[model samples]
Target chain A: MPTQILYKPLTPEQEKRRRQRNIAIALSVAALVAIFYAITLVRLGSNVFLRPD
Target chain B: MSLVSESDLGQQSDFGSAASDASPSDYVALLKPRVMSLSIFTAFAGMLMAPHPVHPMIGAIALLAIAVGAGASGALNMWYDSDIDRLMARTANRPIPAGRMARGEALAFGLVLSAFAVLTLGLAANWLAGGLLAFTIFYYVVVYTMWLKRSTPQNIVIGGAAGALPPMVGYAAAAGSLDLSSLLLFTLIFVWTPPHFWSLALVKAGDYGRAGVPMAPNVWGPDATRLQILLYSLLLAPIGALPWILGYAGPVYGAIACLGGLGMILGGWAVFSRREGDLARKTAMRNFGFSILYLFTLFAVLVVERLTTIWLGA
Candidate 1:
């Protein structure tokens, strides 16, 4: 038979912390994507494919 | 709903609450940030050592992709090894085993990150780096964590390849291919791994034995493991000097490598000479600590040498 595991609900403080942490992670991921795109723009503008003779 | 029993309602509530309990940090913990950092640093060194120049942005992207791929492997390893992880005191508090994150959630997270890292790296850099990253993830998760870890004493010997590949991947990212220098870097890490990991295995042999993992000290006797560590250290010391001997690194790097190599040998000797209770454990711990410092110092010196050359235009 499968084991029955009990779960406890988070306290208010824990729940608040979780929400804040999630928000931070979302913001960080967004920032990384933005940085990547910004760099891509700079690379394209600089003529990445052209080589100096 | 009308026919549902109270027990069923309780079980449903428990399951729902479990999802809410996982914090973002718990998810980040799944990534094994420390291991990711080491891999990133080594990869960065490889990039800097390569003859070809990479744009700063592209280098950053390649590094980020590699870091993400490493994290994906860590998460998958944790998910699969949760059973043994719970058994070991050192790993018992990890997010998965601690119930902060569900195993299924970790598995899905790892898979998604693995795919994303490979695809993005292929687009940003070249396919070689991307392919290496994908293979590294597969090797760590499938070959190391799932297969070798439980099955043999030589687990770390083979599994170390995954850890050793990041520099080569970074070299490929910057140069668009690999060469002898990158292979030397890979070999250095590969040879260094056994002595580095075995010291910890010696200290944690009981935990491994209890978990039914065939770590070196348990499979081979402690005396034999100690001797093997010393032997590997002997090989590693000379190999550590090869970059300088090969004309890639400067005199400063050569000096540090020589000193670090000696330190590793001394640490190994201490472990080999002393094999009693507390003294033996202390010696093993010292070797473990010194091994980390040795690798870090060697890599740092390489970075410094490269930066100096670049600054001097020599």
Candidate 2:
């Protein structure tokens, strides 16, 4: 076998594919954090932006 | 002159070099995402029904920890069972057995996830949650993977404890302690697992027997295991209804629990009615398919009721 670590570093096309996945995971995790924070804001009985006192 | 000679063929799989693309989905497969999803959903339901409130931030983190903990167990399971997994067609395509990821990588991933999950649950939730998470890992890896599976006919029966702990972990995450309701959730899954898995074993008996896996159907014979399935399903009905009987849920949830469990009974009966072979395989497949939905629907009803109570302040 080509050295296990060296059995073809991913071709450029594969690297680009991997890059897209990396971006998706990063975006998803970041969006998850933001969504959870918003849920917390609402779950705690906060609708401040929508309320007019 | 063929490019693929005997010498080249010998070199193909040396030291985990394989042709499969190792993409993000492959790593997600390493997490056993279906199992993680079930664990997360059930645990979240337990948290919702617990006595004390959890901060939503902490709740999300706690759920993530539980999901990670379940994933760690899965990775470890894949590591240990890769041998049998390769032998069985149903599991042959998994990340480890299919050689999509190296055994060493899977092992390290599991260990790291194990540590991170337990420690984070402890900090974000409570020691009880953390402790339960740790024990779940040990139970799945040590008890199910190492001891009971290969050694005993009642492997899944006795080893179902690890699979049943998710709700308890979730309950403790919210309340910082255990309660009868959560333990009831634990017991329900525990009772449900034997019948659930035995149904699968019914259909896969040949594969298991080929792998020398000592499944109940292979060792104890199909008729006995099918009867055992009926007996457990018979037992599961009453206990499955305990939450509503205990008064945590209203009639809507109670009726659904009863009916869903009754569906399992009918499915088990369908298996019980058949003689072993393709006939029994079809029946067992019915039972196996319904069992997953049965548990999910039962829990889903509980969640729906909880959300309704919160919405209407019922």
Candidate 3:
């Protein structure tokens, strides 16, 4: 026989923690992407931003 | 038995489906990020070592493709070896084995990433780099994981070529071809792999035995494995010195390489001399740790020397 299982809603504190963790992860990934971009700019040298003309 | 309600069936199905649910982190875990980092660093070194200049955007894209390809290979390996991985303590908690991700999901993810990496590289960079990336993925997944890992004790020895080829790929990306310097980089990593991996195998022989994988220490006995490590170390030391001999690296790099090479040889000697028990395990691990340091130091010196030469015109 199959048994029924009820879904439980998260408590306020648990929801807060989940939101915080997600934000942290999103920020970390954003930081990593930014760093890769910065490295690319540096590698491209002054010619990227400066023009002799 | 009484008939079950539709609600009960729905709940049961939901409970069953929960096990297959995966988070973003689970997908990332399939990538083996540490291994990808090593590939990225070595490939970056190869790109920097090239005599020809690469457009920065192209170089970045090439590296990104290499990293994705490495991750794809790692994911495929995890998917195929999930059964043995469950048997081994060290890998028992990987995504597939731990049930965080399904086997089919991992397989599809790996295949998608592999195609994405290869196609992106082919379109953005030269076809040669893309071709090499595709070949590396095929070699690691098909040759190493599916075939050699279970069949032979020489698994790492032969399979190390896939790991060794990233530098060549990077060189091809930057310069559109390879040269002696890039080949030396490839050779150095190839020779270093055996001693590094064998040391780990010595420590994990029981795990490998349990998993039915024919690692060197299990097949050849610890004594023979130690001797092999020593022999490889001897070959590796001279190969480590080749960058300077070829006039690519400066004297500082040469000195560090010589000292690091000697240290690697001595570490191997320590492993070889301590023939049994915990002492042998410790020494083997020490050799393993030193081998990583040796490779990192050699590459670091090369990169630093090149950067300084370009910056200061020294």
Candidate 2: which stretches are off by over 4 Å?
Answer: A1-53, B1-21
- Candidate 2 chain B, run of 10 with poorest lDDT: B11-20
**Looking at candidate 1, what is the lDDT of residue B43?**
97
Candidate 3 positional error at B240, Å: 0.6
Classify candidate 3 by CAPRI docking class. Answer: incorrect
Ten contiguous residues minimizing lDDT sum, candidate 1 chain B: B10-19
Candidate 1 per-residue C-alpha lDDT over B1-314 given as tens digits, one digit per residue, 9 for 90 to 100: 23444365343232234334577787789999999999999999899888966878889889999999999999999989989999989999998778666677788889988998998788788899999999999999999999999999999999999999999999999999999888988999999999999999999999999899999999998999999999999999999999999988889889998999999999999999999989999999999999999999999999888878777884
Q: After superposition, how far is residue B94 of candidate 1 from its true place, in Å?
A: 0.6
RMSD of 3: 5.4
lDDT of 2 by residue, B110-194 (tens): 8988998898788777889999999999999999999999999999988999889999999999899888989899999999999
Local distance difference test, per candidate? 0.88, 0.84, 0.85
Instruction: Evaluate residue B90 in candidate 2 and report its C-alpha lDDT on the 0 to 100 scale.
Output: 86
Q: Flag the better candidate by TM-score, 1 or 2.
A: 1
lDDT by residue (tens digit), candidate 3, B128-195: 88999999999999999999999999999999999998988888888888899889999999999999
Residue B246, model 2: Cα distance from true site in angstroms: 1.3
